[model samples]
Target: MKLYEMRDRQSFGFSAENPSGSKGGGTRGGDCEKLRPCIDIQPGETVTLCETQGPGMITHMWFTGYIGHSFILRAYWDGLEEPSVEAPVSAFFGCAYDENFADRDGNYPVLNSAMVLVAPGRGYNCYWEMPFHKSCKITMENRGAQAQTLFYMISGWHGAIPENSGYFHAAYRQEHPVQKGRSYTVIDGIKGKGCFVGLSLAAGMNGHNTCWVEGEAKMYLDGDRYPTMNYTGTEDYFGGAYAFGNDVYQHRYQTFSGLYTGLYAILGDTSDTYNHQKRFLLYRWHVKDPVYFDSDFRMVLDNLGWTGPRYDDYTTVAYWYLESPAPTPVKLPEDGEMVMK
Candidate 1:
């Protein structure tokens, strides 16, 4: 099963099985521009994006629209009721903050990687190789106030997936106003064998003139009560030093869109709460160095700031690959809790 061996083509999208990009099955272009059909999902309605029995791999997924935390995207593997991948549409693709954050100059901050890329034109793309043996299902829900217009495509090929390939999993969690002297759990309730791959975080401070970079990331493996692997601070885990240095420039060593890690966004303000309500978005991928766990895995981040302890709002989506499906509750935050202040 070579990757580029030219297999059969299979695409599930909004199109009506049109071979060419033309409309009305004619050569001319008069009223044949209905090639792309978009859907409007009202609140509380779930729309099935893709469902197929496969011995194939999903090669590419591309979606772009006004997606936010209120729009939930879920993916199910095999015939499981629980979704293996569930998160807000924006956060799932590594865009944690505002979607429309561009000025007249068209300068906007975004995060991009080999697997996930959020382009400047609001095009969200995913190139993860999701291989399933029995079946695969993908759905989207509109949990927000206004209706959502979605235009997307899921393209893949029919072939036998590799034997040792693990199932991909992603979970979104958050702890509002992190407790003092306590740790915020990024991922937990795992009951399978998997390797931690990547994580994206959105941190917001709630205190006046408070600093949120004095935290550390910890990973507990295989029933260990304490973390076997721990880092010094939050910024350090995201490939930064000295509170990101306020350089306002992307550096190689500090943090940028490289191969393994990146610091995507840092939204700070001087007026609100004396800059204590500022927010930061950071991400790290364990592509080269994955945290392998056999029995279970848990990840946490310290709430310690610069001076003693602190409290803040922390939200994250943890990405991993598991040998067996570690079914966890797909409980999302309430409508009020999901909204970012």
Candidate 2:
């Protein structure tokens, strides 16, 4: 069963022959200006971008100064609207290069950083690999400065599938901007363990803080389902560890033995005033356990031997299990390729 691909923007509409319709079907076409390298997904396989040509893999996506843009990759399983899994593209995880602030209306300062430029000729490219069974749709929207022009160069694999149950891992280089206050980024919060990892520079005790908030990523057990977990920490104890703050103040111990979801980052207090590019990086991991603090899990930070901010470039791997058998097998195209019509 190969995934369906519709080239014509109008093909997204409803047709008796095509029940599922097209991507963003019945919605405003203007919302998504279909670019090139459109792809179809296969169940349980990996997609490699370097194997193909054209904009199939994204090299660079540029937004005009002060304008806000969002790129969403959605997966549809069994006619569902929202993707079973989704991740946003931004500077928080260091996948982006430049960062600048904007007012409520999304306008930027006059001396803002230059636009992200796509390499000349044909070297621009980006790749997305997957390890689950799903149908995917990638959408990029310019929500701010409607008239601004955006340029995105992509080159890579198209709709390849992964053989396991993991998601795509993204890494990139980023150039920090010289702003008056500290900048923050959100790294991964889509239905997994609520743990988050963050990195930041030190300025003073005033501008140092780290936290993990929980609202989503709850899993079902045999008879009991656990609620979300929230934890916060600062540089106060053992340099920095974990703490608690929110509606209630209580110690919530967790085990990573089951499914989890959450986001993590380091935040600095600029209101009280702190100067200096404090380079610090941290990671937050959240897990749900029936037994609070019984299980012992060690947190290890491996230095892959890179320069710059210690947290600038790092990889996070997690381990969990599902008691049930594997998910249903997804159909693949007859030609052993994604179907793009």
lDDT string for model 2 (1-341, tens) is 34495432121222222223334433233545543223322333222211121112222332222212133222323233433322223322221212333312233212111121112221112222222233323333322222332233222233333343333322221212212222222221223322122221211121222322211222222223332232222221113323222223443312111112221222322232445221222222222232122112112221211121222222222222211112112221122111111
Residue-wise C-alpha lDDT for candidate 1, range 1-341, written one tens digit per residue: 48678756454332223223222432233475664456788989988877777676777777777667888888888888989889998888776665336522335656678777777777878776787878878788998888988877776766577777788888888888788789998898776887999888887777753456778999999999888989999878888786676433542213366556777665655344444466666778888889999988899998776677788888888888888654553467876677774
Q: How many clashes (backbone N, Cα, C below 3 Å) per candidate?
A: 0, 45
Q: Once model 2 is optimally superposed onto the true structure by TM-score, how far is the C-alpha of residue 311 displaced, in angstroms?
A: 26
Model 1 — which ten-residue stretch has the worst lDDT? Answer: 14-23
Candidate 1: lDDT over CA atoms? 0.74
Taking all chains together, each candidate's TM-score versus the true structure is 0.86, 0.30
Best-fitting candidate, measured by TM-score?
1
Candidate-wise lDDT, in order: 0.74, 0.24
Runs of candidate 2 exceeding 4 Å displacement: 1-80, 84-88, 91-128, 132-135, 154-163, 166-341
Regions of candidate 1 where Cα sits further than 4 Å from its true position: 1-32, 99-106, 208-210, 247-255, 270-276
Best by lDDT: 1
